[model samples]
Target: MTKIHTLSCDIETHSSTDLAKSGVYRYCEAEDFEVLLFGYSVDGREAQVVDLANGEQMPRETLDALNDVRVEKWAFNAAFERICLSRFLGLSTGTYLDPASWRCTMVWSEYLGLPLSLMGVGAVLGLEKQKLSEGKDLIRYFCTPCNPTIANGG
Candidate 1:
């Protein structure tokens, strides 16, 4: 059997722009846009996270896989990952990574009449090690815009 190279990724980002209102492209254009964390697994193995917001560099292997057409990139919402990574890699504004090389699990779930979210899908499938229940709350805390106040460590 031929082995296929796949990199599954999820990223947490912080942006002043409202992603729900503006969409991924506009969200990427925000001045305060930043990729806080990049989590990925190679060939379905255990995942690793790169803490970019804290100044951690992505590993060279992950970098190469992202750019390599031979390596199929998979994510729940693949377009977001591709576009965000394009900006993070300093690609020209409005230009994004090739969508042809990416796959979206959300699309698959929708096609199968399953829930679109990772957590929802896990619950539906009764998968072991389902997504964390507190993930959404944490995402709201770290990935969304917040008032800059002394009490909140602004």
Candidate 2:
């Protein structure tokens, strides 16, 4: 087996709450939607987060790493991250990273019939301080369109 250099990444995306209502094709094509936040760890250390919302971009090396076949990318639900990154970077997912090179932690969790959420999985494994406690709220706020009143600051 070939040794793999792993890069763990998590991305926050903005989309509608009603994914079904918009459909996958439309949802993926939604306007003003892009990666809001990116959290990543190389070899499981030196964790870093970049708020793309603040006009931050991943380091060139990180982008290069994604294009390298020798490096494996890990994400909880890699398809979502991969798609989001592709959209954000204006590159097709097929051109960025091979699906085979990405690992989904959620898959492992599902294999064990354990909880698939990051927090739930962390809790099950006794991991201290899972990524974000208020991830749902964050997702709702950033990913979905704000309520009309809230958007209007009412």
Candidate 3:
């Protein structure tokens, strides 16, 4: 019997998805959506980042594992990753990665009465590493429609 491999992934994306307005499915379904960066770790290995924005492709084996239900896939809010990646993989909007193979750290956080953000969980759990403080500013700058003001250099 083959031992199961656990793969954890995190992604940064751009979409018209007003996540607060539309739910995850609709958010992930935005026509302009595209994954920019992909961070991942397999087994017990140190994580690696793939600059999808720079046109890097995931390794064939990693792609195979993502499509393989036998291996476990995990993320902070895994449903978003699963649905978004389905689109990235050209599986169409309604199609999805199997729920049976996906795990959500956010769900687990809610279940444990912990905060449901990477930063929150890290602080609460006293993690040595945490989400970047500048990430939100960066997201606002690039992930949304920006004002064509002089400051923005439109």
Candidate 4:
């Protein structure tokens, strides 16, 4: 069997800018933008979630893998991961990681006439595990911008 060196990753981020309006570049430029969690699986191993929001550091090996061109990086929406990581890694403001090393499953799904949502993809592929419907609420509360108030810390 051929061995594969790949990382499948997803990141949850918080930004004061509206991602739906400003797009990733501008959204990430927000001073308050931060990666809350980074979820990844390496070579099909059990997935891990790094709680960056709580000051957790990513493993050195995983960090290296992200920088290594030889290691493929896969994600449902690879561009977002790549861009967010590029910012996190302190790359120059206008620079981003090379797109050649990344793969986007969202593009593949669209090519295959599947919906652009994880739930839709799960339903279309008849996968046993589906993305939780409740995730939307959590994302709204944490990942998107909210009214800055004393109670929630904004």
Candidate 5:
């Protein structure tokens, strides 16, 4: 029997002090931007996280797994991951795996005309209750620039 390939991933980002002004783009280009997190799983199990804030890096084994053609790296927005990995590893991402090899959950969701958000899909599938009741508020807080204390600079 053929063994299933593992999925590898990494997430790069910059956190914004203000979500409103920053918007989603802020995560892509924050001044202090860096690869904030890394995730990987084998056949969708044993998911792991590496927090770059703590100076964590992928183990040599994980890096070896990435070079295995049998493994398929997964990501939400793969381009970000690819670019971030390229910069972090000091090697062109092309050397490890073709960009086409990575599977994007976000793209799959959109193909079904479902909400593009990971949280939205989870809710629709009844897999889990929405984690954030005030998603918009939280996104605004963490992602977007903060609205003026008073509207219109009251």
Candidate 6:
């Protein structure tokens, strides 16, 4: 089968919730923020997870697709993936993946009167692959910094 020039991406990043409320612009600027996990699909293929913290390199095809202006990128909240990837890719501030090439499922969900979260949307749509239930907890534990307690080994 011929592969389509469409890439779907999701990223887990570290940033202060306080700062992120303003916008992704400020969120990307956070001193400690970094991409920990990256989930992606290319040409509508099966999704794959890249553990960025574990030194996994993105496949060459995916990397090329990311920079290729022709590839259409998508995500539940496309802005977060696009913005975080921009930082991870070392693009300058105010400059990231072109929005024209990206699509946001969140916006589409809202348009259709569906919930904003991936899980909520999936549940409502009865998708077989629902978003993981422990995602929020995992995110809070791994993506956010604790109070720096000795017990937690911070």
The number of clashing residue pairs in each candidate reads 0, 2, 0, 0, 9, 0
The 0-to-1 C-alpha lDDT of every candidate, in the order given, reads: 0.90, 0.76, 0.86, 0.91, 0.62, 0.84
lDDT (Cα, 0-100) at 56 in candidate 4: 98
> Model 4 residue 76 lDDT?
93
Q: Go through the candidates in order and give the C-alpha RMSD of each one to the true structure.
A: 3.0, 3.7, 2.4, 3.1, 5.6, 2.6
Q: Could you give candidate 4's per-residue lDDT for residues 70-154 as a string of tens digits?
A: 8899999899999999999888789988899999999999999999998899988999988988998999888887666954775
RMSD of 6: 2.6
Clashes of 3: 0
Q: Look at candidate 3 and tell me the lDDT of residue 110.
A: 95
Q: Please say which candidate is ahead in lDDT: 2 or 3.
A: 3
Q: Model 5: residues >4 Å from true position, as ranges?
A: 1-4, 8-12, 15-32, 67-69, 92-97, 129-154
- Top candidate (lDDT): 4
Identify the runs in model 2 with alpha carbons over 4 angstroms from their true place.
1-4, 20-25, 92-96, 149-154
List the candidate numbers ranked by lDDT, top first.
Answer: 4, 1, 3, 6, 2, 5
**TM-score for predicted model 1 compared with the true structure:** 0.91
Residue-by-residue lDDT tens digits, candidate 6, 1-154: 3445899889888886544456777877888878988899887789999998899988877877887778898899888888888888899888897788888989999999999989999999999989898998998788876676854785
Candidate 6, position 77, lDDT: 85
Give the winner by TM-score: 4
| lDDT of model 5 at position 90 | 51
For each candidate in turn, the TM-score is: 0.91, 0.82, 0.90, 0.92, 0.64, 0.88
In model 2, what are the clashing residue pairs, if there are any? 14-143, 15-143
